[model samples]
Target: MTASTDLLATFVARYPAQPATAFWRGIEIEQLARAFASDGVGLDLGCGDGILTDILFKRIGVTPRLIGVDIDPLETEAAAAYSFYDRIHTIPAQAIPEPDASIDYVISNSVLEHIPDLEGVIAEVGRLLKPGGRFYFTVPAPGFHRNLRGSILPGVSRERYLADLDKRLAHFHYLSAADWRAMSARHGLALDSATGYLDGKETRRWEHLSRMTGGLLHSLSFGKSRPIEIQRALRIRDLQNRMALPAPVASGIAKMIACPDAPDSDDIQSCLLVTGHRPRD
Candidate 1:
């Protein structure tokens, strides 16, 4: 994958069930691939379904000794189907079943924001990492809700819409770059870098695509109280996933939805990539 088009196509093929998510992940997955190594023992914190890790490792062309963990049994069960993770555990983020300083690295993709007790998880990461081991995570910036493109309909409240959307997405935290740095330091991890991605334009595009693809189901399922079950029971997810397209066709669709603006300005970003490392001392 030389350009964004190739990365987007990969996600489009794997995540046929959620084209919007694919569009979003297309950018995130690429950013993530460049931020880490392809070897060593890594723990996928909150590894939902394992598609992201699988695609990420494929992009890197190396499969490390990877372990996946999730609080939800259903998600862990689904993640077990993928060969990316050597082991899958259904456990709380605060309580991973691993020895202290045993892991070489820890990665959590878009999972930290949904966690209410983020401090506990970060502390766990510090404890689990072999000193000098890194912790890589992605979360929405404070601008996430502000960057959204809500309904243009008359009498539509953007605040109301965004709040509802956040609830539906189960987002609990929208931390600033500085906030992440401070949190990392508190957990004995030095903040290495914090970069922004998913600009305002692309965030808006994602919102549009999500509404077009999963709006009805979200409404019917009462803000996705049981989105997986609903999608499975209706066979909507199965049908969507089954329609994976060839690379060329997927690329074409991705190009159409691709956002041209780059996330150069930090203030306008909808998401952030934060990396920190434990001190070797």
Candidate 2:
């Protein structure tokens, strides 16, 4: 197996039940079912494990000619397990295997943030879609915290938080709601609808503290008893407690004043669900 395929296989092995992955897949399937109820071809870009593809097939019942593409052969192999798809293609995001304007609708869920060349991928999406075709996709909004810092402080440097963001440029890109609108407009696409959510600083801090505490606990149990690790363990636990203590007390107060139009409480950040269409002649 190639190195790329091997790495993805290891990832799947470690987190076979990727809850976040399943959540995004369900979201995509629901959106697609509502938009395209009839039989029509669709493409699932970066179709890891084919969970979303399976959901689309079962829910839509359109028997739409499905094509799933991924760079990782292992993921492609996993995707192939879903017999519903008419074909499974493995190729880089910059260069899809299919010809231009080949599909009716394109579903890109949580895939753009990882791509380094955002413009290139957007152009490719344009190429793949028929005139007036719909593109339903979601990207990570700015201010996404993955528990790197012990707490979410005001004015955190974007550079530090997204240090690895550059590495996955080929796979994703982080953009704000306004930025996404401008991008789609530039690419000759019109926005249909959008949604946003609030990612309060407190909630982010709590998540960070939880991860740090978990990591420190694992290291202390397994790693050497270095002085640094000892200090870090104590520090992480303290931060965890400080950030987690007042969540319940403040929950009621937050609800009374929270924005009504904001996305469901379950949403992690200010995500914008955008549906764009290519203008017809």
Candidate 3:
């Protein structure tokens, strides 16, 4: 393999499996299985690493003809071992490599945040799903928690971070539950459900610490001091993350912080679970 390809392969090989990643994999698989009956063809958009694809195959046992699509060739290469995908398509988020109305179910998880043209992607997802087919996905909710470093520094002055945040959030456009509902309506889809995933307070605490440390490191030039320093920082981050609270507990704390004013029934902040359906003729 070429040097660049070999480097990517090594990175993929060393990528550790984390609890949070496993939780989302389970969520996506369960959502897809619940949405479709046996023998249904499904499309996994932005199927990075194919973890969710494998989960769907093992849990559902339907052997649903699966098509995995991603923009990253390296991720697709790493996903080759899953063997659940009947085919893999490398395509941009705004355009899918599938015939119109060809898929019975469409699923995306934590992928929408990275796409610049979300509306175009939504339109493409709509075009790809057959009538009555469902789309299940998640997106970060709009709040301080949705800010670039919101999960890293809760106590920093908003003004201090706003400029830096603007640059980061530029790559991500989080929507409120209402915003998603309206977006779905505009695209001839009905919002079936919306649920939050983090408490507000917890999100703020995580963001506060993360941002403070990150800012200090940036200002001290630690991030660029040397290749060794960069590697050291990465190691520390991995250790800190591993030592963090369990997913359920972290999620609970995030909801409390993010939804302080929220009603009892709606108390999540960071992630939102959304399901929608295309209108039938």
Question: Taking the tens digit of each residue's C-alpha lDDT, what string does model 2 give over 33-143?
Answer: 555532467788888766555545556565557788787775677678676667888887777888887778887766777666888778788788888788877665654
The TM-score of predicted model 3 comes to 0.64
Across 229-273, the per-residue lDDT of candidate 1 in tens digits comes to: 666787765565445678888888878777766643545788888
TM-score of each: 0.91, 0.61, 0.64
lDDT of each: 0.81, 0.55, 0.59
- Stronger candidate by lDDT (1 vs 2): 1
Q: Write the per-residue lDDT of candidate 3 for residues 55-112, one digit (tens) a residue.
A: 4565556665678889877567756656668888888867777898888888787788
With candidate 3 superimposed using the best TM-score fit, by how many Å does residue 126's alpha carbon deviate from the native?
1.1
Cα error of candidate 1 at position 24, Å: 0.5
- Using lDDT as the measure, which candidate wins? 1
Off by over 4 Å in 3: 1-39, 56-63, 144-156, 159-171, 201-268
Give the root-mean-square deviation of each candidate in angstroms.
2.5, 12.0, 9.6
Worst lDDT 10-window in candidate 2: 1-10
Give candidate 1's whole-model lDDT. 0.81
